[model samples]
Target: MSRGTIYNKDTFLTNVANQLGRKRQTSSVSLPKWKKSPQYDVFSELSEDALLDEFVKQCEAIHTEVIVTEMKEIQKVCEQVIHDLGGESLVYWEDPRFIKYGIDNVLEKKRETGMDIYEWSSTKGTFNIEKAERANIGLTFSDVTLAESGTVVLFSDKGKGRSVSLLPKTYMAIIPKSTLVPRMTQATDIIHERIKAGEKPPSCINFISGPSNSADIELRLVVGVHGPVRVTYVVIEDE
Candidate 1:
């Protein structure tokens, strides 16, 4: 097809000049100033017991179940929590080959609750998000942060996916109390050290402080908006 062509050098130059002027104005434009700087108390004074109690209260308020245990009592506590939550708990010895020992407990809890349990193998294509949405709860082991934020850091490598924590209605995280830190600075240092040692960070690093909540709607607080409505931390202590 033949296209009509017209040439107006002066008009074209004027248009180019106008475009450049607009570009210059945009480039020099300044963003709106924020009203205030975000504030966070990274070094709050909180005892281990106080933190645990507060964490437990937060979990309970969100209808989550906390299963505190020691290394030796993981099995028993897992069974009890499952039974109390009206879920069946079974020992899947074969799971150890693929899933972490702590995650196996969470999977057992899901199994008791009649949820399907599958090993997250690389060959197993991408996970089904729809199925995960229907799940009542998700359980996993976290690399506990020693920071005072009471955050649980989890990587999305291996069988653990970030979706498992976000998609489910409830999330039960297993953390060792011995790994607790007094502040977030310490947590960052630990992560930095790991990175310095030539260790690749996990695909995801989630710092969960409390259940998913939002006060966006008319300033009325709501829980479980974009993620799990309930988050329970099972702090494992030494016997």
Candidate 2:
């Protein structure tokens, strides 16, 4: 099979321009200036520490447990969280941030204690999903975090399977303080800038707000219907 090219695009456009009695435009279009832009104003005055506080408060409202720790204590704190959550088997993304944040050490220590640990791998294929489904805990790092809604953005790739955040019984996100932004406005802007700079976007970008919550059954609030039953955010303060 052969693929089609845009060989006729210019000819078609020239025909249209001729019909309209105008030349083909080549410059990029300018964005409109809105009368009022309130989206960028919210939480604009808050400092980074204040934003972190707001993020924590929002997490509480969404039923997510937030833990603040320093870089040196990451391994200890993560180990404690795993123990508290009764995580016997864990599935995490094959992200280098895990090693930088000391989570690799934590995973190794846990494995030495007989707990099963699985790292999402591109080479493993379907085995990644299988292990994630059976794992007790799923671990990932947030690429961007929104403070207003306590949302963590995950840019999923071959090594960073979406199953690592979706299929496990419990989900944990290691958030660096620098990733925290005001809200979706800033998050989208960051993503747009990256794309505008000619970088290819990820196949999937998930914006998760705490554990999954639903009220479909009898109008009663239920959590974790389609995803992890429990969600934890371990925020590194100095990072």
Candidate 3:
């Protein structure tokens, strides 16, 4: 190198620092303790009814429909929607709650509606998987919902696979009022406690907010491009 263009490592770093207007940080720093602020603990004090009302309002704001129903009227409400959508087939999680709630029996009854209900399980064979994929609607039960975000929390296990929500053209979830929480933080705290108690988390935990949408191509927003185009939550007052 010529004398006029001479440079050392220290000189180069100094010049760069001068241009960037920042001092190089070399010390390892630790983050301060996380103290919960007064406003940080929002939604923990909401009443059950208030939470449900807020949850319904938030869900509708995201283009997701919220259906309020009682435990006894669940089957009727499900049938009404299925008829309205011309839903020929439905795929539901193989959960015992469906039976306990009487939805399974009502759906299984042969009627002129021509609606067939299929139960999804992890051990489903090839034939069953194909049926679920072709089903017109997907139904699953959510354990919790964050009202502020209009988010439904679903954990996939042996009876509940991700495909049940992904494969169908439309998706619906049955949420109980007892499972309603204020926000994700509240839901996560409960999960953390459960883990601390030696409980294994499910393989998949889905926080579904709205219908599947994408604008990756042509800048045109498309709904249900990858998953369901429509999502509905039937919030049952199971109290």
Candidate 4:
């Protein structure tokens, strides 16, 4: 409206008003997000038990083995898995969540197991990953477990580094029952809530649903092409 203005001030004001109106409408709009999304989720209902059952089913479909056990039995299962895999070397994240479950201490008595147990390093490059690549088994504590897709989420940081789960031949994730959610949307909501509460996410958030596999090469399926050949999920109910 200024005198001798080169631009169309009236038109610009009208466009801005339109945008403001849209924003206002958006602010007042509401959608039932908790309800199943027709475009994404297909489940009609999901209870705690239903979620666990669906999660196990999906995991198995992707060649992932889900083992439900008590907290006391977890250590025994990990040791048994090491023996069964003939694992000469093992690696795990140093996250305190795993420590609370005694997973970190499992490797403390490394000499007795006769296997090299390495912790994920914050340092980059070959010096850090050399031990990880040689390890036959890798262990990690998941941030969230999505029941709909059987997905285990891990955020890589100082204690929970990336290589421990990625470079190894086989990967095992220990998930607490409380971390399980009905779907990816619910999991993301919880993450967002954490962020709003001043919890900073790590540099990387890895979602592992099953073993690494591909079928594109010569139209023949192959495992361990991109990452671990086998993936295991050990769910602790009492955690």
Candidate 5:
């Protein structure tokens, strides 16, 4: 049969109409415009110094060692933290200059401390998952915002895979203070902008408010159930 004759003869439309029955008309409600509210500053009350102080206190309260230093001094801190933790150090960076500088600084520190330093290569994506888990510490950058509930948003595409941050026993995220956001909604705005610009979201987007924690079982509090047991945020003040 001809295609048009076959379709008309089959009663397909009738069957579909019967199955669907009558369509209903519904009214649509417009969502409120994205607006910044005064409450956005609630989390911002913690000044840069105050935030660092509170961050250290929080880490110590959970028995995690935190080393606060300028971004330029990160290599030194990384070497020290790795030696002190007694675990092999793994460094991941996407920028070539920073990577070279980091590797050189780490090597120099390694010479003094006898700690092993390994450069993470992006070509080997899955190769480092296990190593990061066994690592004592993981370091990476943050696509920061000042209005994001004092939170840091880390994209796995930034070179530090999500596993590096999530599976490790301790995680140190380096976010510049200028990137600090006042609320979570502002972060959403940033995400929307990227999406609108036709950018794929990263493999993972971690909105880490604090360390991994839970109060799910019988109201007894627990920490690090699904991710790292310890998380230390280093706010890089100088841009």
Candidate 6:
């Protein structure tokens, strides 16, 4: 079977249809309209400011630090986070958004000050993963932020390694205010719309909430077992 092609899908379906003595239905069906769509209704009345407030509240509940600041102060806030986290080395995605949002300045200044910094690069191959493993911090921008769950959605690609957020001791996300949504429902809708418009969706979409935590080990809550121990959200209020 070819890649992306289902192995014997038509034959399997036809066999099942023959057993039922019916023809295979190939027409599309319309979905029933629901009376109540609570998914869309939740936080529907909230203004942008109210959404940010809710996002911050949710972040606090999850033990993630939320630093709300304007665009002009982004570099300063990033520097403060690095200092507070004792980040001697950093790894981040090669996203242009970092440069657009002033995070590039932090990388440049920190590198000048003798702190090691690595950007995810396809050409670097496993070298990116190796550096990310030893790096103290990993930084990236959230494609869509879920205000209700305090989740930062990342669209990872060749230039954006999923391990950039997964392998670091501390994970930081720059969340644009405009990317804030009420919940996962809105986030999926955005992705669905992109697909409907003939756009190629990201290969990997990660919804990270705070830091990694699990209660699977004897029902005891453990942090950083699967990923970063500390998570920080730097919200650009003016964006």
* Predicted structure with the largest lDDT when compared to the true one: 2
Q: Per-residue lDDT for 223 in model 5?
A: 82
Q: What TM-score would candidate 3 get against the native?
A: 0.78
Per-residue CA lDDT of model 6 for 1-239, tens digit only, reads 13485799989998999899999878888879999888898999999899999999999988899999998888899999988888799999999998888789889999999999889997888999999999999999999999999999999987999999999999999898999999999999999999989988787999999999998979988888889999999999854
Off by over 4 Å in 5: 1-68, 71-75, 91-97, 100-104, 111-116, 145-150, 198-200
TM agreement with the true structure for every prediction:
0.64, 0.88, 0.78, 0.78, 0.65, 0.91
Expressed as tens digits, the lDDT of each residue in 1-239 for candidate 2 is 25567778989998999999999887888989999999999999999999999999999999999999998888899999999878799999999998877789889988998999989999989999999999999999999999999999999987999999999999999999999999999999999999999997887999999998899879998998999999999999864
Which lDDT tens digits does candidate 3 get at residues 12-59?
A: 877788789997555788758667655446776779898888888887
Which one wins by TM-score: 3 or 6?
Answer: 6
lDDT of 4 by residue, 189-208 (tens): 77788897999767788888
Where in model 3 is the C-alpha error above 4 Å? Answer: 1-33, 37-40, 110-114, 125-128, 215-221
Model 1: residues with Cα > 4 Å off, grouped in runs: 1-65, 83-115, 128-130
**If both were scored by lDDT, which would come out higher, candidate 2 or candidate 4?**
2
Top candidate, metric TM-score: 6
Higher-TM-score candidate among 3 and 5?
3
lDDT of 3 at 222: 79
- lDDT, residue 197, model 5: 100
RMSD in angstroms between candidate 5 and the native structure over all alpha carbons: 7.9
Task: Report the lDDT tens digits of candidate 5 across residue range 51-129.
Answer: 5565555556554455556767777665565555445555444544445336356655564665444445677766677
TM-score of 5: 0.65
Rank by lDDT, descending? 2, 6, 3, 4, 5, 1
Off by over 4 Å in 4: 1-44, 123-126
